[model samples]
Target: MSALPVIDIHTGAAPVLRETVLEFDQVAVQLGGRQILSPTSLKIGRGEFITIIGPSGCGKTTLLRAAAGFVRPEGGAVLRQGRLVGGPSREVAFVFQDYAHALLPWRTVQGNVELALEAAQVPATERAPRAQQVLQTVGLAAHAAKFPAQLSGGMQQRVQIARCLAQQPELMMMDEPFGALDAMTREGLQDELARLVRETGLTVLFVTHDLEEAIYLADRVVALRANPTAERPSLARVIDVNLPRPREQLATKEHPEFLRLRRELYGYLGHGHG
Candidate 1:
């Protein structure tokens, strides 16, 4: 008997040179005497939105961290734009789930965003316009002068996102960014993120435990299994979302494909108990 073929869900658009923005070549990780991730191989094309979903301790965030060069894999390699990733770079921006801690409380919204540009050493004269432009993109232009403590949870997250955008990164690593928000806020931010990614053509690798959220925003969803072995690898499945774009929170979730994907992924994560 032979092993089953790995399912690849593609949007059906041919990529030029099939350009790969990120690749994990048989990557493996161990942390504090535990195997966090087994050897896994994956590729992300330029401008593609790839979401990672799995049960707790399944290495979703670890994978994202490896891509960001925050974690070193014990075996194999991670590549960005075909070059070996050494450490964190300006070209890759990370958005944490805790927006409260991620944003500097004392800094005004614009001031916080300005930090990215300042780190990149953009001339002082050019920083404000760039920050404002990104703030406008994320619908935070009007709140530029407000402090993080003055804003709601969702708006604070937007400020963090705006700061990342100010860096003009080619790739964004988001770890459960909307996980802390209320349902309505999460849905709104999902749509907003989808729009921004479309407009900017930025490649993203998002981590989430929410199956529906994974299917909703991803061009492709990568499902992982925690305890990987030779027979059952860490990369359990790769599902392509064929749902229509500009997805609506109400209508899109009601779509047949959406329901089917939700059910399929639920089996992997055992989602119905709660």
Candidate 2:
């Protein structure tokens, strides 16, 4: 509590906060003439792990896409490292939930991870070592030569993460990345991902429907509300987790603060299917 800057995103937290990595200034979006997000604003600091959760159609994915420059906002703006995010950049890496479609089945694990370096035009010789390093970081070094078809769902997802790491991005956008994994597998990867993000010091904006996942992995949880109006805006609330680092799936989930936050956020999710 003393040194940690787990402060509200929309409020006064800059003094103790790290350098801003991403900023959403009155951001809004619409689809098919319907407003997807209201005028929203949040400042995300470097190395922060922010999780977004809300009901279905609440623009969780839309907000994340906007941050990554994959979606254009109808109003307001998204700034990355003080520059307006007009389009996707090599410094930003996106991790899709569907690992099956995200990875190229024709390529080996190492080859897929090398795609990022290839896109950046890194030398062919440099790509190998970089790809291998990230693969090893994700514990997939032994499976480098294996094809995506040969790996399990969790392993495939790990490859996808490894690929993002190879890009050496300043920000990582994860959209319900563990949503498709089994309960056990999801918990395991949650730990692995938390560890990876900590070690790499990459700022992450993660979207999830799971209440516990949102609480366990976030420095602050941004809860959005669907079908926004002036009375009920899209950005419902942002709560600081304030929990210690290196969260354990079992122990952290059972922590008093964790349970309290879970109970607090459960109401917004409405049966947790969102």
Candidate 3:
């Protein structure tokens, strides 16, 4: 393992020293004779907004899935609150890229949000109000009775977000949640997501291919190296963002600091603008 720098944010809570919420300990993943991830390691503190960015085959999504318990690491470990992640925990929620497959068509927006609570066997009397509150947070409470087909692509994604939120998950793992939407819609949802994270103090691990999106949303951007199985593997890099909090669409993107950070991230990804 390379010498990695650690950053700490004190939450002033006892029983936990420094509050290391999620830790990936030298994780190496292999699938189908291919090295999906190579001895990767990272530590995310509570309430952090971490964005993972990398090239297509660099295992960004795979890492997220592993964190969500969909895949296991061949080496190293995935930990949540100092415990090894054996399976899907109630505290970790996943939002997939494809909303169509993630949500059931037969279930209404509200129903989709309530499915997790239902599986947990939350009392029926409390499900509606909980579901409604989350939907409202995603700006979809009015569309509760509507089905996925009745909403736009953005709205469907909102439902997905609402569904995850209703679980009251302390950790949210989102894999390119807005990649399928139009630019305007993507930006709109991005703002909404930032708001939700701030309001709920959700610890987010978001994966995206878009550098601008990464810079705009993340407190730190972790860039993955090239495929480890490749003839020559690149180096993994992490860029710390010092931008001030409470990011908005226009103000954040247009800020001089945002551009500088974006440029640095692109450079770390081996991209340079002429």
Candidate 4:
């Protein structure tokens, strides 16, 4: 396995804390006889928001799935809170990009959130209040009684997120959760998600194709490459984003560091330069 570089522009910034919540130790994966991910190693600290960005088919989603225990790695291991991830657990909740299909069409928004509790076998008596509280956090309490089809795309996505929050998970794996929404809605949810993560203190491994979104939401960004060999691994770069918190969409994007990081990681996304 090749060594992956961690670029840190913040000399005076805080170092990654010691309380590691997730570790990908030389993890490798193959799908249908093709190596999807080469040996990749990373340690995600507790409450850290790490975003994965790479070109399409660069194993971004595969890596996230491996960490979530949905895809078993062919080599190495994925550990959560110092334990090997055997399979998907209630403690690690996954949010899909396709909100339209993720929710049960027949159920109300409240019922959708409660589905998490139901799947976990959380007591039937406890589901409604717990689901309602989560809905409030995602700003969907007023719409909870409505069905999924009754809400807008963004609202349905919020319902999906609220369901994950209802799970009360320690870790969240979001695979481009806002990729399908319109730009305005996407930006709105990005801020909402950042706040939700802050309030919940949940560790997140989010996958996205948008370079700006990746940098805006991540404490550290992980870049990957496709078609790896022994000399060239799938993992490319891990960069620390030292921008100040309470990031505003307009102001934060204009910040110098944000632009610099965007340019630095821009090549990895395989898009035209700045």
lDDT of each: 0.88, 0.88, 0.83, 0.88
List model 1 lDDT by residue over 1-274, tens digit each.
Answer: 1121222333445433446788999998888987788889988887788999887877888999999999999999999878889999999999999999999998999999999999999999999999999999999999999999999999999999999999999999999999999999999999999999988989999998788899999888999887765566788889878777778898989999999998888886686311
Those runs of model 1 whose alpha carbons end farther than 4 Å from true positions after fitting are 1-17, 229-231, 272-274
For model 2, the local distance difference test gives: 0.88
Tell me the spans in candidate 2 whose CA falls farther than 4 Å from its real position: 1-15
Tens digits of lDDT, candidate 3, 136-229: 8888888999999999999999999988888889899999999999999999998899888988889999988888899888878888876575
Can you tell me which runs of candidate 3 are displaced by over 4 Å? 1-18, 229-235, 271-274
Q: In terms of TM-score, how similar is model 1 to the real structure?
A: 0.92
TM-score of each: 0.92, 0.93, 0.90, 0.93
Alpha carbon deviation, residue 153, candidate 2 (Å): 0.4
Q: After superposition, how far is residue 32 of candidate 2 from its true place, in Å?
A: 2.0
**Predicted candidate 4 versus true structure: per-residue lDDT over 1-274, tens digit per residue:** 1222333323334443347788999999999988889899998877789999887887888998898898999999998878899998889989999999999999999999999999999999999999989999999989989999999999999999999998889999999999999999999999999999888889899998889999999989998876777578989989989887878999999999999998889855566311
Distance from true location, Cα of 220 in model 3, Å = 0.5
Range of the 10 consecutive residues with the lowest summed lDDT in candidate 3: 1-10
- Angstrom error of the Cα, residue 176, model 3: value is 0.3
Clashes of each: 0, 0, 0, 0
Weakest lDDT window of 10 consecutive positions for candidate 4: 1-10
Measured on C-alpha atoms, candidate 3 has an lDDT of 0.83
